[model samples]
Target: MHEKDHSEALKARIKSPKRASRRMSMLLGAVALGALTTGAMLQSSFDVGPTPAYAQNLSAQVPAATSAGFADVVDHVKPAVVSVRVKVAVEGASAEGFDLRQFGLPEGSPFEKFFRRFGDEGQRPAPRRYGEAQGSGFFISADGYVVTNNHVVEKAREVEIQTDDGKTYSARIVGTDPKTDLALLKVDAEGGFPYVSFARNAPRVGEWVLAVGNPFGLGGTVTAGIVSARGRDIGAGPYDDFLQIDAAVNRGNSGGPTFNAAGEVVGVNTAIASPSGGNVGIAFAIPAETVQKVVAEIKEHGAVRRGYLGVQIQPISKDIAEGLGLDDAKGAIVARVEGGSPAEKAGIKTGDAILAVDGHEVKNARELARDIAGFAPGKSVDVTVWRDGKKREISVTLTKMPGEKTASAETGEEQGGKLGLSLAPASSVDGADKEGVVVVGVEPGSPAEERGLRSGDVIVSVGGKKVETPQDVREAVKELRKEGRKAVLMQVESANGARFVALPIA
Candidate 1:
């Protein structure tokens, strides 16, 4: 789904309840077998006591089979559920501020004089509106540590949590990991609190689960459903592995816990996919494994530290795999290696497809990113890559990711005939790299323009090799053409940034 659509769906789930319900009912069957007690009747006629054999026989009948219900599970887990209320300072016009626009008066109108007497003509300070938002959370420890979504308490001026027992306590933010949307909070309580632990084993996809949260400000709401799917990537973040459940999760359910039949938290209620702003039997939660790791890190370090490998990677598509002579469209293709990054230091090159990290198979770019981020900085790991139609492993020592950075574009150029582009040495253009050729002009309706090449774009590399001059670009293109390649990949650097463009060689 589109990012906007997912965000809209998540927001909608917070305000509306699920419209569908699945009622589970159970029936019990009882059968009674009686034997004529002639001895007991004769004893009653004689006024004798009841026989011990008859009473023992009556007690030995088969017991009825009992069906499982959620009442016991709810009773056990609901006490730890909490309602999180946040007070945010919203910026807007205050009620005291008077505007002539409200009276439908144009600028410089005669009525401005009458309004000016009531309020100042100059811009008044925007009113600070105190906005309150509600969500759900649960206690993770007895000492008053609670876990919730980061978005629930983010940017809050004041936070308070209400337990199921109707007692409210002021909550302080302990730590938060925005990447996974998880936060740790602490409440000052007198004694040990009821808490739940994360499930050690992952619940099966079809297993029944319970969700308890404050949906739409409804405190202590309970809903039941099954785990619909696993490892769902809803485009939330780099670590997008979420569990999809059919629970009736709605607004105010953020940061709630999804428990398995054992009453262990299997996931944290996060988002839903609903078009009408309500649960449509599809809700997503952060898996227990991810939550456990993030929460523990937050508790220890107050932040999440992710390992970084400096390279821009893209998923290997079937066509890309075919172009690279690969058997399967698996792995992440390195588009560009950041200068001085660990990947560059370890001799990782552009156009190399990463297949595994430390022997763990990486299926695609997202998987690779998640796996790499899970490691600690300064840890060395073996990375397997496919280059030149062969597999090789390289050991790389990870480093802490520096703040946000973007790869600069690099491109190469050659005598443009079929592509129809005018090229010149990049050194000829100001602020352009000296090792590539710059596009002086692109012919209208040509393959160069169609491939997004434009004037002032520098070509840094052709066919994954650096090119300094037009002759170098021509040589690379000639090599690819001799190899019968249909398209040549060029690394292009423009004002926006660096990106790889595949232009048709024909």
Candidate 2:
């Protein structure tokens, strides 16, 4: 996706695959605002994913540079970096849309005038129009296979790569995975090409790192910084494990490489957090661990397939922990179990707190998600969940993730008293769940609204007890509060599907 402005605090984000990494855009007047835009260095006008462990060479590249400098490392890996340019049909925009900001080109880019000559994006020209997207990439093999962000070549009519020697060559897309925001492109005319390897070890936070790629069309730009942090989720995608750095990552710098002291590619620059849509010393990169795994799949299968453990999940908050009769707020609570899913087949149910997977302790929701995705389809694994105050283990066979998951899930009836909800028996409503109470209304600025409850939502149960009417719903809340529960967990079924929403009792 292209760069977009944030009107408020990182509240909403607009992005599509194209050229360059994205940034957070919040239009803050006197205060601070935050927004996130993506499509990192070099074009599908810039859009950019989680990855598995990539096998890489562990041999030292001139040893780790000392505090003195990174001159040796930079000299070794710069040749592998290249500027990626994708020419798409003038009107060949993605279903979402595209614009100059999406392209992330510099002010003096040669094609800017031509794009404006035709007409505004709203007004299409009679003749075919040709627009180009640019970002960055580096060769992964001597035979000329390059790795870049998927947004760089999305909907591309043709691809052209510019090497360090100022030579341009045609390339073809091998495979692109939007989930990981990574793509593999092969150069047609193959000779021995300058290539780099993914880092064998993850870089430590505060360790020295270098970023190399095209920024604002300036090729071979090099900047140095330290790994600011690790395991950052920028809400870029479902699998959003990014490396945070302090390097100067700009619009045209997306898809570039971030290297550790060993001259190995540790990450691919993908996004930044800035209010003005420029560098603010804060940037994001897809870790080499994910990159190597994703690149390998694309090279071999021409597509990426991830494992799926179907369940609607949310974090176990402190209040929820008290309600669930647990001492600590850890692991992920199953809000809803997908019908006919591997989870459902394994006897997993709503309100089950997933504590471990295959004996590995589950820390939270994100950890569970990543661990599940790392597995291959058809693999049977042990899943342990805390149910009815005890941990039970079940085996589940994972399936291939579907394009779109249909929700078959729970919500509860409402009582306007303390919970600020109005309710009716489901039998009283024409099109409602057969066994629950319907939510007729939610009080304004009420706890129900804060938890996403709305009219027409069916409340199936409260505190694990089924409720069939307004009185039943009221009794459930009253009983839970009397038991010293801080919140009430309600199984709600709405238009989207059924899930659990916990509302505070105080």
Write model 2 residue lDDT over 284-355, tens digit each, in one string.
899988887777666755666566778878788899888888888888888878777788898999899988
Highest TM-score, which number?
2
Worst 10 residues of 2 by lDDT: 31-40
Model 2 residue 466 distance off true place after TM-score fit, in angstroms:
45
Instruction: Assess the local accuracy of residue 252 in candidate 1 as a C-alpha lDDT between 0 and 100.
Output: 88
lDDT score at residue 254, model 1, on the 0-100 scale: 89
lDDT by residue for model 1 (1-506), tens: 99987776555322212212111111122111010000000000111123333122111121322265777777777888999998875544322234455567665677654554445435553345687888899987767789998888765668899999999999888767766888989998676677777777998989988899998886799999999999976655556788989989988888999988777899999887666666788888998888888777667655666777888887888999999889999988888887888889999998998999999998877777877867776779899999998999999998766431111121233423456565777764557677688886555346775555767878889999998767787778888877888889999887656778798875
lDDT of each: 0.72, 0.71
TM-score of 1: 0.62
- Identify the runs in model 2 with alpha carbons over 4 angstroms from their true place: 1-60, 66-68, 92-127, 404-506
Positional deviation of residue 490's Cα in model 1 after best superposition, in angstroms = 47
